[model samples]
Target chain A: MSEEKRIKVLLAKLGVEVHWRGVITVAGMLRDAGMEVVYIGNAFPPEIIETAIQEGVDVIGVSTLGGNHLTLGGELLELAKQKGVKDSMVFVIGGVFPPYDIPKLKDVGFDGIFGPGATQEEIVGFIKDAVSKKLGK
Target chain B: MSEEKTTKQILQEAEEKRKAERVPLYNPEALKQIKEKFDQWYNTKLREEDRKNWFVTPQTILGSEIPRGLLYTPLDVADLDYMQDIGFSGDEPYTRGIHPNMYRGRLFTVRQLAGFGGPEDTNERIKFLLAHGATGINIVFDLPTIQMYDSDDPMARGQVGWCGVAMDTVKDWEILFDGIPIDKISVSLVTHYPTNTAILFAMYLVMAERRGIPWDKLIGTVQNDIIMEEVVRSGAEYLPPKWVFKNQCDNIEFIRKNVPRWNFITYNGYNLREAGTSGVTEMAVAFTNAIDTLKELTGRGHDVDWICERLAFFWDPSMDFFEEVCRLRAARRLWYKIMKHQFNAKSPRSMWMRCHVQTSGISLTREEPLNNIVRAAYEALAAVLGGAQSMHVDSYDEAYSVPTEAAALVSVRTQQIIQAETGVTEVVDPLGGSFYVEWLTNEIEGRILDEIDEMQRLGGIVKVIETGWIHKKIADYAYKEQRKIEEGIIKIAGLNYFRAADVKLPEIDVFRYPEGVEERQRKKLQKIREERDNKEVQARLDELTRAARRGEPIIEYCIECARAMCTEGEMFKALKEAWGTWRPPAYW
Candidate 1:
């Protein structure tokens, strides 16, 4: 079999109101795992991530801590669909999100959800596992 | 590094300039007098006379803690030079003051920070402040407008009209400036996170142009303090640093070409200070961030002279009187030294520290709220003595909510009292000759230089920020300060000390969001989308994307996107695709 493709992940803190610590940590972890990664800056909303995904990113991750997660996050997932990559690229949500909000977030079509107190290793392992399972490698 | 050039050369330069009066020794009599006063102040309430102790404690930022005190003495600053190190105002090493005649028979611009609900709401407040002795207006835009999102955007729901005024187009800006004179008053628009600031300024300019207002004659400062935005908010996640830096460069270039007289960014340490940082971190981080931006601007083919003059600083004045004074003095001196020694900035104005000071918003406590008036009064006086070019005193009741009209008026009166009642305006740099003041100045200057060196050793402020150095520092400092207050060690009057029994606080009146503010803003943005040439907006956004791909000036394209009603998030996303996100370091 051909060598397995190392999944590429780009992380961002989507929306205009949130800070970006969690997303950055996750991005660093992804990079350390030999995943080609791109980081969009903070306060970036959905459209930016969707556009970045058009560059052939295998997964798009967003971290948010502000109050507009439901609205901004929903819009981001919608933009992903609008950009025609809802299934092609996995989308993840992370930040001060509570564990209870994971179902709601997942229902909104976010591929994965990581909340407060999540370590970088956990996020990287999950992304790697999810991408690996999807690629059948 | 030679002793000869340090002492002899400095003395010769002083003698050549007819400034040599004596060996630069600390005057024994002055030191004694300063110590006597300091002892008296420290011992006034102490149980024992021997309890009087003086020491320089370093206060930390978000991540560190250093205790500071009320006074600093000549003993603390014995190694500092008056002529060579402190230097003359308007000269190299501007420690004493930035300009030769700082406070030049002119008061710091009394900018009233006012904006809320909508443009009309802001207009009324602007009129109110200007009528009440406010020499200028500092417009604070709401999160919706600041982030370049239309009020109707799902992301902007409920957030509309919460922080400040919401504006979506040229029409909104026109209404905001309705009767305000662009030429007469110095307007400073406070904005951070330019994902939308440049476009907003462009929209304001478009309206100004439509009104036949000369763009060159229109003066105002657009605060593009993007570096400290992450720290100001609730440490949430956002874009990567690379994109933030790119956007700042685009704004610098855009302002250079279109709004030549306008200040593109006012590297804001004050915002972080308001978010609760110590005086040293305030200056260190502000300067560090400014240097990062300056280096990038210069690297992007922008001349230091052209960009430096348009550059400005925004710092906060804390309650610590002497420390605050030293902060300003140290800031000026450090800016001068850095511009000359590091960047080779030759222009006098470029080296001068032209800053705007706002009384600490974070310091205004929600308890014993009226006491905030006292806090603001002292802070404003510190800014005046510190030779701030512009200042805004926080409303006494700002901690609870938006300042009531009475509270805002008291804020204005606080500044007026210092300007008119206090004999401080009669002489410039009134505390210039104080040995204690000079000592504190050197202490702060020394500490700031060390901080800059540390940041430089970390590769730069942007690198340190990426490494989460600044963020961690600020967080640690915040946590320590909170613990101190909680432990009753650093007693806050209302919170810790002076407990009162069922105290009924006075009802403070302030601005309220207008009824249906969200609906009105949403409709306004909708109208903008419907009326604006949809074809033009698309063409502009495409052009903006193309410019970003080419690493061209993205600001003009951003303005075009703004005109097209492309939300702030939309404009930023287009750029994000090209520049990629900022990957914060994993140190935090």
Candidate 2:
């Protein structure tokens, strides 16, 4: 109980979207960085929240490329609030999000927002620090 | 004469044997001299000098790990047959081009994939581009349409009109091409899957029929390939490869018989390549699919020549400049060989490898977006130099959304500038005789053949797909490429490397979907249900179900349903009931 546990990250792809290389690459990088990662594919907002609660994952990463960020990301946050998992988990969203959508997604309650051209070190480091803070490490 | 063998007689017999075996392009003695010279140069310049460790292994941008030599010369292509291999353009084994005078005869069609918001919005963009001198029309459907979900479906929420036109019924198809001179302006419907192609393309056909346009008079292409549905663009509920191929063949069978001028199927190497396979694997997969299509079509009692005459290819020309050029060249030559030698196809037109090229969108970066313009231009130039029949240049802003209007115009103008200003199209295959190109062309052909053999060994490409082997292979290559980029082995400007801080990136406008698109589309679907012959549509749906169960081509039934105002989802649902849905092997 006194020691830190390996950060459990759950990566969920929103909707039946294609062009998922970004998410898959992130998953691999996280796994290699000694994180327990469960990738649930083609999920909706409610399912993603339910899975996070069930899996008790420290971080919830939602990747979408279908330009449904504002709509679906907001829906995920709304559902996470109703499910009351908003504080227990860290949320990050990455995809083909434009520069303008960054502040909007941040306002939608995502802790981390990544657009295209995000590096492995940046994403990984951000997740590690966020998860550590969530665990009060 | 051989019994009393004079030296000349013996030499003549040896020459005859060599002729049967197809001797090298250069004399053996000459090649030996060239090899010695090459070795001498390599030794003196590198090994003998202080830069002894200067030899760096060369690889492609996509990293098939196909080694590249320092230089290619006549020695590399010593065995190439001039008359047999690099024949004149329009001849057998068309390494030069399908047409002798390529662009000089008919300039390549400049088409951009345009669709977003509603059908009317896309129609307006198509008109704008055409007014700006775009030669043809190409349209893409929104996620719901491509995924075969109606606008009102729960799974389709938040996605309607998000990226492409929100098409659901024949009404959308009708509105999409409202006044665009259908017969004259060749339209490419990116109906990316067999199931969707059957519905969307059927709606298109019905619309044309309503307008009194004969299907035979229309010219366009339908993306009716099986790989897109089963492999490249996979979903959990896609129909199994076994039945999906049937839907694909049915569409092609009907199209070849009815719309003879239209390309029935474009074996989409673009989607497959964009899924993150190497450039070489792209051709291997496409030609493999084409070979399977040829077999299935011929098995349906269609003549091989008739089936192949309108067959086409779609390629994603990435940043591998020379390899992209060589790949297209090798693909053309290999296709001709497969037609002539393997299938015994009779018509020369049937053997032609007509392809459309779109510069690789996966190669674009969101950071410092202007660099993408140069990347796209060079890729487009590769396609043009490689002799694509039609071309599309990816916009610099595509990493974000379906390109904005300004970006779309730039893409169209990119092709125009290539066609008008570059002067690269004046002659056919100017790189045809270059030592590097010819040597790489032959090398790529051999490697591609080896790859095809590998596919055959794995029980053919179709079995490979049905077994989920292709997905695994793609993932492996994709991961490898990602690692390469991450490790700085492959330098993507403004992304992995060259993060030039001093260069000011211009503020680019991103495309936004029109408001209430989903509401408007749903209203139209509701209105159609209220207005159309509902009983007739249900009856046609039953016909479609029976057609699917009876192993008949369902395109006819789909056309009937489209004419009856049935929606794409209705047809898709009917087929799902008849043929059943399938889940692919979970790689994650």
Candidate 3:
């Protein structure tokens, strides 16, 4: 758990939807995987991504089960770019996503996509790999 | 000796005669020998390989604390009394079922819960379902309507016409049921709370009156179970608990005299199950709420026999196939005992526990959405086996959003296939005599009774809810269930085990609400406001407010308000002004 190598991730939900079980479970898994995880609670506004930048998180994971993922998830990426933190933070989207929307999300610059039932190992590994790649480790 | 024995003595003799004629399925020595042989075989042959290739963890029966054995025998049900506990179907202590013929005589009502967008949108869906052979209609109100707000209110932004249909006034109700035969088909409105339920009931009466149907001919249920809503669902209480109880009793009293055929209240435990409480807790909490409501009513000089006859129960059938079946059976027996022995109900109909079941919404996974169709089929089968009087199947895409028309049809078809294709409905209580089911029914009944006793010790359901005890219990279970899933202790098919690769995911069309649904609903509400007589509406609202302040029954006044074309928001505002709103105590 060296400070230089430890990964920091921010977990949040988009819009006014209150489906928080997945994100909360993921936050626990990430913490157990030896990463610092900050969870902004359910139905948070997109501006919270700026808080991730202020805290210097290496990855931002947004979970939404509501069908507003297209609008809300896209708004999150747009907000991150506006805040100039889009390049610094790895963006991951998860929960209730249709596979056809994956390409559109990827085109919007989301680095990883984890739909429902994404295992803890895969999520932790994805964050670790993304952090290593970003840091050129 | 020739003199006629008392009825109780005669019944006791009949029960003893039946017991004496029954022979043991297995002798004690034979059972011991079988057990020893099984143990030897397990140790000598299958133990190591079984442990290696399979996860042979101790399996606890779902929703109960008891662990399951490899098999159950007559020994498991040795203590059950056929007459006192597992009576014949349509008899006293009706553990087998309420009806003598059960599904053999008639299939359970296939009530599809449908509503979304605006009134017209939901109306079309209703017509589509009826055309598709749906036997009943369960209307779902949007969040704003459930919260007693007008669609046009600023408080309803982004929420209007999203979750369910938005009905702000009688006009919306008229459009929602325009062509539907209100007198023929059973309609259930999924609305809780006092004011909102009262408004909807009043609107229904007015709608029927306009259609030239008598009040006595109306058949439906308004789910006015406020206690469940306060403890598990939204936890939004517009008035204090006392007023909630008062208003609920008002509806019951009014319906008991006027609308004798309608179910005034449908006590629900389905939401508690969705909130992650165990099956036993769901039953206990639901019945306790019913007992509390009955106490309030009888305390006000209403007869239990009359009120209990019109009450219905709602439950959830989760993936626990046998457990859910046993839970429903146990619920019927437990409720029978409560009504007949505790409350002194005179009629058998008053003791009957009629229930509606919905497949578990929380069990559906967004991953491998098609797999949900299988999950729903099994759950629907369980509900049928459990003897539900009506049932709703969850749509595969429900885990994502409000079900699309295609998904909703699939859900209805799931029930249809189970009813029409499968021969499961040919027998009355087909699983009734199974040793494991009988044993589990008694076990679940005991656990639920214990929970009820604990609730009574804590000063009843209302007290537990007021102190936030029940909410904390539900939250605790929710957390534990999540943790269990994460640790792989409880396996959800596509979720924990058999994980699919992302590339293998299927693409499906999800339902999207039409653009400008909110604006359209607002415009409709504005039009109603402009067209209706303001003076009469205000006068009716004033009368409602006065009735509330006077501590009198408000249902009749609410009817006046609805007839005057006062909107749901206006009626709720008057009541809220008269009786202050309640804020749920933070329990977590």
Candidate 4:
């Protein structure tokens, strides 16, 4: 029997989102929940996805409160595909996104979308499920 | 009793009776009976149903979930002395208020924080606000300007005009206040330290001089409160803490001698509250910061009365109604005692706590953004009842973006409606004699006093900041508050609880600066550089560096540089050459 792999996630802030409180809180919570979480503070979308690919992270979680999530989120997915890591890596977003943008976010191939009131448990559970499903577990 | 009682005994009995009468209308025995009946009802009738249907969370004030009594009576506040603690308004230890007839005589100054994009954009907003009856102008600067960077710096990309107006040179200031008169309008530069403020102050002086306004006639406030910035916000230490202090003291001392009408430093606790501190922490930190600054100034042979009299405060009035009100009242009383007892200040003006309040931006919600208007209204009402000297209402769309002009106007109207239509301004300290408010005031006062004492014991505010003690406290509270919200312990309507399904998301018109604002700002700086006398600019910068190195007051030198048409970045570079910049200790 193969042993279960610990889910490796990379969390980053996209495009000048200087509100670090949410990103810091989510990083700490995910780390305590037994996941290998790498936080790349704040960077451009392409730079963030490059770090995800380099770190071999199974999930890329982008945190933003700057209202540029739609444009940046779409660019991140496109960059991941160009880098040939789309099937291997799952994309997730968490921050202050309006309810109207949820369907659009999912349509852009995000595995999960966490808004303002998402709990740590919900995030951990979703990340675990998404990673395992991607690995064909 | 039959024997003749002594004269002292009669006086003591009268004093006791007066103390007992200061509490609620009910006597102690009656209050006890009411509490007993409430307990019985809570246990037998309310407890079972509360458990079955509704989860009873603790009623908290600013994240301290201590249980409060259902009602308070004379018993709760019998120890308070009316003469010493709860004196009349405009009297010694002014707990009720600093003015005799606060709102009835004059309403608080309605100042909206208006700034975004270029100088022309902010200038238009200021004119609009003034036309709508705004009494003061609170100017917000862009991140680059606040960080002491030029607009053309590579580090300032994408952030030049997004947060606030991008100001790089004296020309920007001239355009910022184009048609507005400096003497009539009270302007506050909501900028930070350690050198940005000095540069901004120099620009203001240069502008006034160009317009033939005297130094003493210029009226405004520059938020040179670098202590709170070090403690809570971006831990960006432009220079070492001691250097920052020296620069701030230079401004205070220079302004005291030259510009008597301008407030040199406004100790801001609003950032602390926004960073998730309790009311007690906010009050304690602000007081400690002010006390430390006064001590430094006095040690330098400046009069304690002069510094204390000119000092002002900026606070955040959150959604907790009574607690917010009590926080301001207790702050006034505590500042009065601090000035009189600790500093031995004799001027009554020195003892009065003059404060400006901004409604809490942390309380605004991104879910139903319109609900923020209601939140701001209640907070503004609390600030009014708490006796603020000036107030700024946060725009409803602040959660999503920098407020559009429409949203900013609505925010100003929110305060206007409360000031004109609502009858809250008819009386001074309208909730003064309420039992719960009095008890809360006493409680908050005691807690803040204890924290201030602890800070003193921990080697004053500056030392605590250098050691990261207070920063740790803020971080711990912030994490706890976030956890409580995630756990559903703290219920925010439309966010955590009572969330609506199938809600139509409101289409907010987020303010977007015109493209190439940063490029235009850079071009303006270049034009000033090419048009001015380079030799004079270089000479002024060299003098500024020498004065900084020799520990001389550099405000005059800064004004010289401003007069020579030097850029902010050039002044900052000159100072950096004299005293190298500082890097804050790694926090987390």
What is candidate 4's lDDT per residue for A16-97, written digit by digit as tens?
A: 4445566767877788778888876656667887898789888899887655467678878878889888789878898766
Could you tell me how far off, in angstroms, the CA of residue B42 lies in candidate 3 after the best superposition?
Answer: 10
Mark the regions of model 1 whose C-alpha exceeds 4 Å error after superposition.
A1-137, B1-23, B26-80, B234-237, B503-506, B563-569, B580-588
Clashing pairs in 3: none
Model 1 chain B scores worst on lDDT over the 10 consecutive residues at B1-10
Select the stronger candidate by DockQ from 1 and 4.
4
In candidate 3, how many Å is residue B538 off? Answer: 2.9
Better of 1 and 4 by TM-score: 4
Write the residue-wise lDDT of candidate 1 on B258-299 in tens digits.
Answer: 778888888888777654567777777777777777878888
Clash statistics: count for each candidate: 36, 0, 0, 0
Model 4 C-alpha lDDT per residue in residues B298-338, reported as the tens digit of each score:
99888898777688989888877888898889889878877
- The lDDT values for all models are 0.69, 0.83, 0.78, 0.78
User: lDDT tens digits, residues A60-79, model 1?
Assistant: 88766543456667877787
Computed on C-alphas against the true complex, the DockQ of each candidate is: 0.08, 0.58, 0.17, 0.20
Question: What's the residue-level lDDT of B330 in candidate 1?
Answer: 75
lDDT of 3 at B554: 87
lDDT tens digits by residue: candidate 3, B116-157: 889989999999999999999999887668767787775465
Ranking, TM-score, top scorer first: 2, 4, 3, 1
Total backbone clashes of candidate 2, pairs 3 or more residues apart or in separate chains: 0
- Best model number under DockQ: 2
